[model samples]
Target chain A: MTEKLRIVQMGLGPIGNKVTQYLAERPNLEIVGAIDTDPAKVGQDVGVLAGLAPLGVIVTADIDAALGGGRADVVVLTTASSMAKVHDQLLRILPYGVSVVSSCEELSYPWQTQPELAASIDRAAKKSNAAVLATGVNPGFLMDFLPAAMTGVCRKVRKVTVERIQDATFRRIPFQKKIGAGLTVEEFYKKVEEGVLRHVGLTESMHLIAARLGWQLDKTEDIITPIIAERRVTTDSMVIEAGNVLGVQQLGRGIMGGEEVISLVFRAAIGEPGARDRIVIDGEPAIDSCINGGVNGDVATCAILVNAIPVVAKARPGLRTMADIEPITCW
Target chain B: MTEKLRIVQMGLGPIGNKVTQYLAERPNLEIVGAIDTDPAKVGQDVGVLAGLAPLGVIVTADIDAALGGGRADVVVLTTASSMAKVHDQLLRILPYGVSVVSSCEELSYPWQTQPELAASIDRAAKKSNAAVLATGVNPGFLMDFLPAAMTGVCRKVRKVTVERIQDATFRRIPFQKKIGAGLTVEEFYKKVEEGVLRHVGLTESMHLIAARLGWQLDKTEDIITPIIAERRVTTDSMVIEAGNVLGVQQLGRGIMGGEEVISLVFRAAIGEPGARDRIVIDGEPAIDSCINGGVNGDVATCAILVNAIPVVAKARPGLRTMADIEPITCW
Candidate 1:
């Protein structure tokens, strides 16, 4: 595996940059090329685009040409949720038998909800005789890995809850817009009515959890809050309006029997941020796990993806979300 | 369509009594009998048991006799969340073709999260040639009905969010316990860890919305906060302990896509109780609707339910939750 694992990076954004930084340290991994929709960075080096100075590798808007370079082995995805739109690019490269590992949050919770995309990715990957693995640190590990860790002491393990509260303004601009900051109550209400301004990523967090538990989530409910701080507050340097906020807190749960639910709680805030999470299990070997920063949701997610690379590479050639990947002993 | 609908009132909890009171005033409905788990209530008048004085109806725990009496056409359920146990009574009579309406919160969201329970109810109802309609004025109607009603104005419905807040101590004690009042942070942690203390009805709330739009939900999550008054906070002649909370605020959400979520936010707090809701959509048509209340949530819930009765009775039923029922014309 150390024979230079040539990688292709897509979606020139924050997490994409982080992925590049982490993979740069790996002796076996080599980023062969990169692609993005932004015209400003098209002819620049991948490292320069990632803000880590310049690497010899050039960025290209032409996805086909990037794949046509023919040096790439695996496509490392950081594309947005609609990464599904890159299906044609995925197909073109998969025929060349290039496997994939992406930062697409949707991959963690793929099977039960995103059946269409999962099926498409699988079909394309199999046709090319390569595997596709998707993941991230938040929905990938923070929501999933920690809960999976709790099962060690839990015997009947009924439910697990994960909460993530982050300042979206500091992480990315799109997220700030996604949370609808600066919008009046009426404007926020309008977006929820149309279903457009709703924040993304957490759904996959819940999906990762349910799939890890091997259940089809019989029922689920949520509340996306665009709360107006009755008392004005600020996070970092952003002065969030006293009555308007982009902060979002949501809950996702899976019920198994009668009224017993396997639950997960998620909250992401742009203005005032405090992070916390807890998970409980019942009936024999009842267990509870709590963490202030939510059990390494960040660094561990990167690890999860890197670790999965080996497992996915050896698996059957097809599109595989975290669910399709069998559990491997990290030890 | 009423023809003096004969109904059996089962359970005499706070919610049960409210339904009984509602039934008392409706000239088109007749309370044939009442059932309680407590033997002390047996042979007592329902009005007395319901705190409304004698109304000529006897309260009995004989579930079999109530179904066998053949005097009622529908079973108004107000039992615990364990409907599998309470549903037995409905099934015994279901074979005789009697319909049901209940405050069984999970029933509204069961098909997605609790398919087993939903399927069983559907099967029993089908065998009996009857219908099962489960609702709550708050969890069912307020959380589900209002958002669905506004969907008419949404062009591409991306997300839906609902928030409900009420003072439970002023409303009911069980709700306070259910929300984790009168406990330390450790105790609250214990309950949430055991999968017993978190919000129960939000999953149904998500299912209600999903069923309405024919959207498949992959994730549902929750966040529960135990509210306690500390150091001589006086409210209406009550001095509460620092850790002895009176209610809880729970937020639950469901994500349809990575960025699109249908969220339900609920609060049952005696400490500081008020509700303000706002929704955000990315489409052309959007909205903002909110209600402030000095009374218990049940008061508003009852109104929401009464408004939806016509919609439920007229609609086709296969395990109907609020979202399955047509939008309430006015609330």
Candidate 2:
């Protein structure tokens, strides 16, 4: 019998827990270890922490012990959103010669914002002969990779536009609160200026698409605004009065030779009436495609990470982005 | 500079003409020869035949001469719709040690219908160390491949359903006629029973999806019904009375373990009010996605075929399907 691939789940946050739960059920993958900084979760059984029947593997706080313990072919890292916060954590894993697939939004395309750090990660991955990749539904799939793939059907593409509207009512409480729901417009702007109430990585998505299409961008801009609630609304966890901030509406654009070649719009709010994902390409035989309901964040993020494990395992040893990989096949 | 990939265009039908036109514009590909049986088109410049500015290469009727011409690495076959008709043509090209990407619907997945022909093609491809694949917009992408890729985001998929409703008024006259528009119900049924008036390859798509998901289908069914015009409709070519057939509606289902595991519905006719493509997966988190305007067939089919050339050129030797290929990358 072919031996199952061993996987270590790093971090036990909501996304991490979901990834672990899904990975535990795969016949081809075995969850060998789990890590989390939470004292409450450190000693719990991984299966229990993931809300599954006990599978005997335990969560630990020691990253080194988790890495040193037996064989782990890949590590699914969902620790933090930024690469800066996870740089050391990733550095610690590379030496163990285990591939890593993280959910860091900024790491999805780090050439513009964190080139030096990306280079360091590349060197570390090469030295250890391991692959590293960052992916999520928004920056990785919907906005960048999917739009780029759609252009494969075009002979000469003039412009690309992608829009993602998500209703936060069905999401977890943490996500609902992240969009500054229920905050006043002034308060929302203050929080946005303080870096606490804004979506990250739209610029990264623009850069990724531009680079893939071989367009040298003159400039890239990101604009964020508050979507004020017109009517009182209540989600599963929070209540928002009329005139309060419903959520955030963010737009990013990549201008090439004075033309806007790439445009991306992401809106996540409490009371979006019709939430969907749309991509339009203005080229030969213009394409207008819409996904009626946008991808489910928690579920799809976990699914993409788990699905990427096998691809990363077989990938060339280096720090790779979504574009660098061959076609991503689930089967 | 690296040498460009040499390509040969076979069959100057609407799809073939579009493929040639698109490929002529790519920097990495060079059109070396063109072949068609039409007496009027045999000696015309390939570009002019494709309705573009004249290219230097002239169209030819001699298949052997075209195959023997210099450095024809791949042949884009669009001559016939069925594998039985295209098998000899594929055999003739394989011995020339050139890869092929055909738009043949039956060749998409012929294991159930023409297993012997498929095996023979596989043997020929293996002997020549070349790859051959059949793909297009509907059977290849919208119904089969795209849905399978979406399942990557699913942990446990219970059932998959894809619906494509295309507005046929924008389509060409031949396509409108193929759907039996302007014909009475009796005439439409007679043509369908004679195997000349129905959409092809939904069964192949069903088989492809089931195989990718690893489901053993108990039985598969295909149902063809006429989409009678509700109101008087006039396309560019023909006018349909209120009671005449406007187009065709085809439905295919795959039953597995006493349940329908895969369902595909394709409706292409005059005056579809809200034409779109939708896919739903009843699995973890339940995915619902819709493409506002179903894929533009004429343009996308050509683009997909031209895009597939490089993939087929680099693939392992066999009668390969989309499922067997490593993720298909556009750039």
Candidate 3:
């Protein structure tokens, strides 16, 4: 008989619930606890909240109550995209000697942008002998880890470019709204100014690639633009006329030696006919790779978080990134 | 200033020479010693043999002279395809507390085929506190590691298939000849009977995928067939007429519960117009990935071996597979 890994599901959001459902399907994994700050979800059964039959694990707002029992080997954290918001939760979990696999975007590679906080987390994890990681489909795997792994087949790498073009029609309603689908051009600009229309983690992905390739960059830059629907575009819940905004195009560049050596382009719109994920490497033995249809973001996010559990459990104590551990696989 | 990692180049074959060239290009890597059993290569400067400026390191025939100096941090070994042939060399190198990254095919996942010998090597590595790995373009990356990494994006995986189609026209003369590019069907059958016509790593790659996916395969089968030329095909060294053998097609299958769940198809021939590397995963979120041009086997073999030095140098002591350490990246 195989031993089941005990894990706590943090943040009972869509991604968290999906991860719970996946854990339920695996006989080698057991969900022992759940956490959420929402008052209404505090006392609900975790499995029931995830749309599965009750597993008898209750959700709690108290982190200590969920993790302090010493039964949790790992925590699946899907709270927020920013490190500033998730830092406190990580600090509380580390001292319990529980490893964490988070979906926090900025925490994916926070060394450059949040060096002090990263070091602090590293210190806490080391003190308690726990491991911490942040990963997802885009920033964690597609743009950073995938390109870095492809470079293993090249003798010399001059430049690397990755593009993610997604069709947002079948995505969750929240995701469709998050990409600024069916907005006027003027409104799109206003939302960009408010910092709500753009995607996070492009810059983090750039830095992760640079760190793995041993490149010292002069600076990193991100540019966001609106992709307007030229014709009538209809989605699951909305309709946009010609010249209206459909989604956003985000580009991130890492400039080194006065040249952009790493470029990541993300385009998400409602009616993208040729949705795909592509990577191009310019060097000796050049590589041109493509995924015909882009990876499903919400589903993949849940999968990567679950897949990282075993890897994180045995990792050396510290703040770890996707590049710091072995390539994640479904187990 | 960053301290350089000292590496000893062993084997002095085509792949070894290419690895030496790549190592010379990196400022963070230094060639400390070179070893070869060939009389013609012994005493020759490794860099000159690799078609580069002389690096002032002479190739020696004795392994002790190359690794016994205690200056080598790792060894780029490109000696043989079988673990049985390289087991002694590994035993000799591990006791020096020096890590090894070989191009041996069977060593990629030897636990299934050579369990007792693999145990011996593992024990030696642990006793000496050194890490040992075997990797290349086929068994190590494209068929095994690449697909396994892609599965990180899947919620559930039902089947996996990888195909490598190569055009032998631009390859080295030796590789063209080895694929039996200009042989009759009868000659090809004779070579197959002698165990010289089929690719060596299909079964190893199958086991690697099975291990990563946590699948218990009942058995695996490899089938080899000649790809006969329908039209005249010409290469730099030879020409083949219609009805003659142009190359080979090799298929490897992994059966689980009496069903074929893993399939790898490798086809290499002259005048192959659509040469590419592709992977298809059948599951909840289907992934159809393709590399427009197949990864050049020889060059990639060299690149992966050299790129693994720094990673192997810092890994924990044991017999490691591609799944055991962080993914290899050019640094």
Candidate 4:
């Protein structure tokens, strides 16, 4: 533990590059290898690709080439959103006995939603004696884990409610487009039908909250609707005429005994006013907490992935949740 | 794990009684025994003493009788505030192989300040294969652990600042007097010299934050001053003159490389305006968070003690800090 910890960066996407940038600044960490399936990313210096000075380490598509030396202590994974998609990538890395901190949304709490895959991953991680954790700003921290942690000061929690409102004007182009920032009402519904418009992790966040509170929810529901533009909204990239869709309004509910005990509301709009994050816990000594101006989503996801490295490195070998590992902090 | 968890209530003070009341409401727990040193409380039923119906469990002065049956899984200890005072009680209970969740403040993070005592407790607990944790609202949750947890979304934290302000008018009489609500300037200075009218755990909280961030601090300092009343302040208990002391303002600092990196300010005064808890993390993607109308001190301490029961029960056999165990939630 006296020596600098070695790390491998996998997936050269937006979030992955941000994680690499943060990891590069840490004096206690050394980037030993980089992996990306993109042909353009392969053979390029990871540091330069992430908008930093070249570090002489080239990105390769082969997992073995990056992990073969067995010098890497942990892997920063930012590959996919679904557990099924990242299943093989996890299996490939867990055998190397290197802990992983991933940004996969569903993997944040996959045990309830994808039990079989989670169990398999757990078994594989146990066999290799390596820990795996999936975390990000939304599912990993803000909506679920933070609210659950807040209950530590409560005697009996009757209900938990959270709201995340984001102003999408300054977000990345990809994020803005993903949220349907400038779309017609009809097109938004069509995209929703195609199952690609809404945000991931609301259901996962709900389950994580329930698990932390020891609540047995009878059922869960997620509703996605459009936040119609009342006036013309303009961003750096595009403009939305009045009566068009500005962004999305997503509401997720966790029910027990036909009562909605947990409610999470997410809103991201180009002209959204009062961007903030709020949590209200109805219990003895009730709490009303707010993070003014909200947490920056993209930047925070990178931070969560980077800060969780040491926690995963020391965690017991298993498929872990944010609740399973030690509390994460800035490194 | 299938059977109900048996619990022993130790130290029948205000907090201890509140813990007992909360534990009695849970269907998954059973009150197995109770222990107290007060002569009048020694022969009383635990439930009745806590302002609840009789549960047939009498309070005993002997620790052996409360923990001897081998059925008790955890002990809810609401005893002294200092490590030296509670050292014997911890040693006596750890040997019984029953886990303990205590409200002792200094035990929250004793590694840096009280290394020998912490090591002794760790050794004793390890020998008996039992886990011990110290937690409450201030040292345990709000100041140290909450700030650390908030940094999970931060990339590089330059500074950590926390403020806990309370309005003493609604608080208990003991709490009001503890903060020197009606003391004059002369009396306040005398009490300060006597070292009796100050808060504990601020230094411990600073150290815990430093440990979580992996900062090697150069030195630490704590200062206490009085907040004088500009206008006569009145409370249910008493009234203070315009020039009299309203309450004490305590500040704790963690300095690194001659820079103040961690600062904690605590204020509890009668008629304090805008009581709140606020934390600011100066770093990449800086965060400013607040709990509107600060968390209640006494009630929250009771909640933290009861909520941490399941976490300690499953932790590894040793003296555990809030950072070592799983994230606590309402359970």
- DockQ (Cα-based) for each candidate: 0.01, 0.38, 0.84, 0.87
lDDT per residue as tens, model 2, B87-109:
99998889999999999999998
Candidate closer to the true structure by lDDT (higher is better), 1 or 3: 3
Provide the lowest-lDDT 10-residue window in model 3 chain B: B1-10
**Superposition error at B179 for model 2 (Å):** 1.3
What is the DockQ of the complex in model 1? 0.01
TM-score of chain B of each: 0.85, 0.96, 0.97, 0.98
Best by DockQ: 4
Question: lDDT by residue for model 1 over A1-331, one digit each (tens)?
Answer: 4377778888777767766766665566788888887988788888976678677888898778888757887777777655566565566668767788766666656666678877887898988889887765556544564455333222234556555555454655566667676677788878878877664456666665555444566666656667676766665656666787656656665565655355556655664455445545442234343333332333444554554554556656887654334332111
Would candidate 3 be rated incorrect, acceptable, medium or high by CAPRI criteria? high
> In candidate 4, residue A314 scores what lDDT?
88
Candidate 2 CAPRI level: acceptable
Model 1: CA > 4 A from native = A1-331, B167-178, B194-196, B227-232, B237-246, B277-282, B302-314, B327-331
Write one digit per residue (lDDT tens) for candidate 3, span A222-318: 9999899889987769999899988889999999999999999999988877899999998778999999888888889889999899889889889
What ranges in model 3 sit over 4 Å off? none
What is the TM-score of each predicted model, taking all chains together?
0.47, 0.88, 0.98, 0.98
Per-residue lDDT of model 2, residues A1-331, tens digit only: 1578899999898889889888987788999888998999999999998889998988999988998955799999999988888788999999999999999998999987789999999999999999999987877888987787777666668999999999887777788789888899989999999998878789889888877666778999999998998888877787889999888899998998889888899999887767888888888768787777777877777888887777788777899888666444344
Q: Is the docking of candidate 1 incorrect, acceptable, medium or high quality?
A: incorrect
- Listed per model in order, the count of residue pairs whose N, CA or C atoms clash below 3 Å is 38, 4, 0, 0
